[model samples]
Target chain A: MNLFQYVRPAEQKTAIAAVAAEPTARFLGGGTNLLDLMKRHIMQPEKLVDVTRLPLKGITQQGNIIRIGALTRNTEIAEDKTILQNLPLLAMAINAGASAQIRNMATTGGNLLQRTRCPYFYDTAMPCNKREPGTGCGALEGFNRMHAIFGFSDKCIAVNPSDMNVALRALDATVVVNGPKGERKIPIADFHRLPGDTPEKDTNLDKNELITAVTIPISPFSKNAYYLKVRDRNSYAFALVSVAAALNMDGNTIKEARLAMGGVAHKPWRLTDAETFLKSKTATEENFQQAAQIAFQGAKAFKHNQYKLKLGPNTIVQALSVASGLKSV
Target chain B: MNEQEPFCPNESRRSFLKKSTVITAVALTPAAAINAANNHWDEHIAAAIENVSLSVEINGTRHTMDIDPRTSLLDLLRENLHLTGTKKGCDYGQCGACTVHVNGERVLSCLTLAATTDGSKVTTIEGLANGDELHPMQAAFIKHDGFQCGYCTPGQIMSAVACIREGHASSRDQIREYMSGNICRCGAYPNIVDAIEEVQKGGQKV
Candidate 1:
C-alpha cells in the first residue's frame, strides 16, 4: 500500500468536512475492504479520514424501526441480542457471508460498500469496465462463472457479493448518510445501482457522503425468514447463488412476502413480481416453484453461469419452503 | 540578464518566489501540506514528518513508536515489533494466519491499520502463555494433534480460544463454522475441532 496521510477525526462533522474538502480522501471504517483494495493498488486514496472512532457504533431499536450504526462490526451486529431477535435474517445473512475474523474486522457501512469479487476486476491488468470505464468488460467474453444473471448490461456483468445487503433490501432498510449538504436517507432498494453504461459507480452514494446508520423497519416476517447461500465451499466463500426469503403467513397462507437475491445482479435483485405472486397463496412447493419462476423471468446467463438459471430457482424454492415452515433443511 | 552566467538573477528570484508561494499554500492546508511533503520530499523525510505516533499495548508490553499510516497491524507486529508469531499468510483478510486479539476480539491483523489501533490493547500468540504455562488451547492442540506442519497453529489456537469465549464452540459443527477462517492446509480440521471441543468441555479458563 502506498504511504498516505491518516487523520482520525474525533467528530463526525470533522470527518465529513475532511472527505468533502478532498476528492481523493476516503473514510476509513474497519479497513477490511479499503485496505485490501489499497494493497492491490485497485484504489489509492491520498488521504484516509479515520472514522472508526467517530461515535457511529451502536444498535438501537425505536418504536417501529431498528437503527444500526454504520461502523458496527459485522460480528457485533450478528451477535447482538436485539438484532438476532428482531432481524434474524440479517444476522443469518451476515454470518453466512464471511468468516469470524473478517466479520470481526468488517463494518456495516464497509460491507454495504464492498466491491465486487469479480476476478477480472481484481486482476487490474485485465480490461474491466467496472474497474476502468470504456475499457470493455473482460467477463463478457472471458471466464464469467461468477458474473451476474440479472440487471446486467453489455458494458458490465458483475454482481454485488454482499449477503447482508440482500437481506437489508428485503427488510426495506434505509441508509442515513451525512455529507456537506447535511443528511439524507436513501431507501435500501435504491442504494445500489445496476451496472448500466456506468459500471464504475457501484452505489447511488456521492463521493462526499458518509454513511452513518441503517434503519430497518419492523416486519412480521421476522419469524419466518431465511437466508440461504449456496457456494462452492461450505463456508468462507462468496455465494454462487443466494436467496433471502421472508414470508408473513396467516395460518397456512402467505399474507405478504419479500424476496431478494444476491450474486445474480449488479445490486440486490428484489423480486417484486415474485413477492406479489406469493401473497395470498398457500405456502407449498408448487406455489414456491411458481414464485421462483416469476423471480427469474428476465434473468440472463453468461457463458459459464447457465447453471444459475436452474440453481437460482431451486435455491429460491428451498429458501421459501424453509422460511415458511413448510419444510426444513 | 547575463545569459553567460548560467543563472539569471531575475528568473531565479521569480522561481523562488513561485515555489515559496506554493509552499505557503500547502502550509495553509495541513492535509495538502502532508501530501506535498510526502510526494515532493525524500521518502524518509516524508515518513518521518507524516508518520503518526502510536502508543499501543501488545503482549503486556507498552511501546511507543512512529509508523506509516498505511502500515498494517500485521506488518507492524512482524516488521516493527518483531512479533513473528503472528504470521502473514495472505497479507489480505482472506487467510486467518494473521489473527490476533484487539480488545479481546479476534480480528484480521492484516486488515487493521496500526495507526487506527492507537491506545488499544493487542494480544498475539506470544501473549497466550502465563510465563511457563501454556494456554489451555495450546495444550489441547498438542494433546489432540491439531496440526501437521503447524504454520496455522497459532492462529487456530487464538481463534479457538475466542470461539469458546464467544460461545460459538458448543458443537462440532459450530466449531467448524466459527473456525472456518483459519485454514489448515494439511487437513487437520478434524483434530482441530477435536482440540477445540476438548478445551471447551474442559471448562478451563482460556
Candidate 2:
C-alpha cells in the first residue's frame, strides 16, 4: 500500500537473507494484521518478504509434545485433532480469537507478532510511547477502558490482545526462533515482555528474528484445561478479560493447577501464587474464591480498568471451576 | 434355472435397454443445451476481452486476460469482464460484500490482490446459473425471499454456494455460525437461513 517492494521467496533461508540484507524490511505472514497496520502507515517497511509461500505450515505431535509450524493457520491449529484431544485449552483459545475469515487467514506466527490494538498506537496523530518513545502516552489520560490493569508503566498501558498466548504460557510452551545468528528456543513466558521502562519493546525478539515454531509440552493437567474469554461482543472483538485454567483434581482436592490471565496485563499474567495455594487444597467453591483473590492480590488497576480487578478474579474462579470439572459458582 | 427364463431372447432385452437409453438421453437434452449455451457465452466474452489476458477458469472455463493487476477479481468479473453479478458492497473483507470462490475456497474478492491469485480459478454469481434456469439454492432464495435490499444478493448467494460446499449447511446453528462472516445489513437473516435450509434439505449440490 505504501509503494514498497515485495519478494515471495521459495525458501526461508533466502527470505531470511533478504530481510538481513535490507535494513527496513519485514516478513509478511498471512497479512491479516500486518498489511492492515502497514496500509494505515502505522508500520512502514521498505520491503515485505512474503514468507507465506515458503513451506512452513503443519501441526505435528512428537512423543508428549505438540509442535506447531509458524505458518499454520489459526483455524487449522484450533481444529487439529491432536490439539483438540491433548491441548483442548490451546485449541479453545485459538477459536476464541477473531472471526472465521480472519482466523482462516491469520497464522500462528502472525498472531504472536500482532501489535497492540490500542487506539493511540493505531492513530498516528496521537502520541504513543509504543509507537514513538518519549513522545507521550495518550491513553493514560484518554480513553483507557481497554488498557492494561497490571504490569504497565506510565509510558504505556495497552494490554496484549492475544487469546492463545495465555494458554500457551500456562502450558509452558516454547517459542522457537530463527535469525542470522542461529536458531534458539525461549520459554513462552519470556517470549513477550512487560511494559516496564521501555514500552516500545513488546518482546525480546530482534527485528531480524523469525519465529519458526511453537513447541508445547503435553501435561496430564492439560487434559482437564479450559479457556474462557469474556468480551463486549459475542464475536469479532478483543477480550475484555479472559482466563486459561488447567487443574488436576484428586477426588475433591486440587492436585495441580495452571492458570494465566489475558487482557489484564502487558503480557500473559501467570498466577503462580494462586496456583501454589491451590495445590492439595479442597476443590470447593470457597477454595476457588480464595485462590481467585490470591491471583488478584498484586494486581495494580487504573481508573478505567478497575472493573477488570473484579472481573479478573471472577473470570479466574469460573475458569478454575470449569477446569476442575465442577459447576460454576 | 427355469426354462422360460432361459428361453427369454437376448434380442428383447437389448431392445428394452436401447429404448430406455434413448428416453434418458432425450430427457437430458435441455441440460445439454444449457451447457452449450454457457460455452457460447464464454466464447462471446472472450471476443470482447481482447486485451485482458487472465488464465482464470470460472465455474470451469479457462480465459486469459491482459488486464490491470490493480483490477480486483470482483471488478474484473463485474465491470471489465461484464459478469456484473458479483455485487460490491464495502470493498473490504469485513462486510463479506464481494465473497467468491478462489480455488474452491470462499475468499473476499475485495481484499484479495488480483496479481497474487494468478492462475487461480474464480467463481462468480453469474456462473451459478444453467442458462435460463437457476441453481437450486438460487431458486430456494427466491422462493423464501432471502433479501430485502437485493443489493447484497450476489454476495449472499456466493457465500451460500460456498456454505453448502463447505458442508456447513447441516443445522440452523451451523448455518448461522458459518454464515456469520457474510452480513446482510438488510436484516434478512431468518429468511436467508430458511432458504439455506430448504436447499440443504433436498441434499444440496454445490
Candidate 3:
C-alpha cells in the first residue's frame, strides 16, 4: 500500500470538505475493501478521511421506521433486536454475505460501496474496463460464470457482490447522504447504477458525498421473509444466484410480494413484475414457478453461466416457497 | 542503534530482539519489546513512509509508536513488535490466519490498519496464556486435537474463544457458522468444533 495521509475529522462537514478538497481523497469507513485495494495498488488515494470514529454508529427507531447509521457494523445490524424482529430479511442477508470476521469489521455504508468480486477486476495484469476505462473487459470473454445476467452494458458485466444492498433494495430503504451542496435522500433503487459507459462509477453517489445513514420501514412483509443464498459453499462464499423474497400474506393468498435478486445483475435486480404477478394469487408452487419465469424474462446468460438460467428460476421458486412458509427454511 | 550506518543492520537487531523477547514478552510487559524496536530503528526506509503517531495497547501493554500510515496491524504485530504468533496466511482477509481480538471483537488484523487502532486494546495469541497456565480454550484445543500443522491454530483459537463468548457456540452448527471466518487448510474443522464445544461446556473460563 502507498503511504498516504490519514485524517479523522470529528464533524461531518469537515469530512465532506476534506474529500472534496483532494481529488484523490477517499472516505475510509472500516477499510476492509479499501485497504485491500490499496495493498494491491488498485486504488491509490492521497488522503484517507477515517469516518469510523464519527458519531454515525448506531441503530435508532422512530415509531415503525428504523434508521441504521452507515458506520454501523454488519454484525451489529444482523444482531440488532429491532432489525431481527422487523426486517428479518435484512439480517439474514447480512449473515449470508460474508464471514463473521468480515461482518464484524465491515460497516453498512462500506458494504454497499464494496467493489465487485470479479476476478478480472482484481488482477491488474488483465484488461478490465471497470478498473481502467477503454482497457477492454476481460471478464467478457474470460471465465465469466460469475458475471452478470441483467442490467449489464457492453462495457462491463460484473455483478454487485453486496447481500446487504439486495435486502435493502427489497425492503424499500432510503439512503441519506451529505455533500458540499447539501443533504439529500436517495432511494435504494437509484443508489446503485448499472455499468453504462462509466463502469468505474459503481453508485450514483458523488465523489464529495458522504453516506450518513439508511432508513428502512417496517413493512407488512416482515413476518414472512427469507434470504436464500445459493453458492458453491454453504458459508463465506459469494452468491451464485441469491434471492431476497418477502411476502405479505392474506390467509392462503398473497397480498403483496417483495423480490430482489443478487449475483445476477449489475445492481440488485428487483423483480417488480414477478412481485406484481404474485399479488392476490394463492401461495402455490405453480404460481411461484410462473412468477420465477416472469422474473427471468429478460435475463441473458453468458457463455459459462448458462446454468444460471435454470438455477435462477429454481432459486426464485424455492425462495418464494420458503418466504410464504410453504417450505421449511 | 544508528540505522543509516553499516554496523546496525535491521536483521541482526530483529533476530536479537526475537531471541531476547521470548522471556520479556511474557515475564514482563511487551512495552519494552516495542520500546527496543523504537529505540533502535530507521523509520525512513522508504520515501513514502510518513510516520503517524499511534497509541495502542496490545496484550495488556501500552506502547506509543510512530508507524507508517500504510502499516497493517498484522505487520505491526509480526514485524515491529515481533509478535509472530499471529500468522499471515492470505494477507488479504481471504484467509483468517491473521485473526486477533480488537476491542474484544474478532477481526482480521491484516485488513485493520495499525494507525486506525489508536487507543484500542488488541489481544493476540501471545496474550491468551496466563503465565505458564494455558487458557481454557487453548487447553481444549490440545485435548480435542483441534489442529494438525498448527499454522492456522492461533487465528482459529482466537476466533473460537470469541465464538463462545459471543453466545454463538450453543450448537455444533452455530460453532461452525461462527467459526467460518478461520480456515484450516489442514481440514481440522470437526476437531476444532469439538474443541469449541468443550470450551463452551466449561463456562466462564475463556
DockQ of each: 0.32, 0.04, 0.26
lDDT of 2 by residue, B1-206 (tens): 01111111133433453356433442322223223333453322222211123456766777665553235677777776777777787664667777777776677776564534556778878788899999898898899999998888877887787788767789998888777777888899899999998888888576
DockQ for the candidate 3 complex? Answer: 0.26
Which is better, 2 or 3, measured by lDDT? 3
Candidate 1 stretches with Cα past 4 Å from truth are B1-41
**Model 2 over residues A172-229: C-alpha lDDT tens digits?**
9999999999999989889899887788888888888889899998888756788999
Candidate 3 off by > 4 Å: B1-49
| Clash pairs, model 1 backbone | none
- Model 2 regions lying over 4 Å from their true place: B1-93, B151-153
lDDT of 3: 0.88
Ranking of predictions according to TM-score: 1, 3, 2
Candidates in order have lDDT scores of 0.87, 0.77, 0.88
Clashing residue pairs in candidate 2, if any?
B52-B65, B52-B66, B53-B64, B53-B65, B53-B66, B54-B64, B54-B65
In terms of TM-score, how similar is model 1 to the real structure? 0.94
Residue B205 displacement in candidate 1 (angstroms): 0.7
**Best-fitting candidate, scored by DockQ:** 1
Instruction: Indicate the TM-score of model 2.
Output: 0.82
TM-score of each: 0.94, 0.82, 0.91
Instruction: Give the higher-TM-score candidate: 1 or 3.
Output: 1
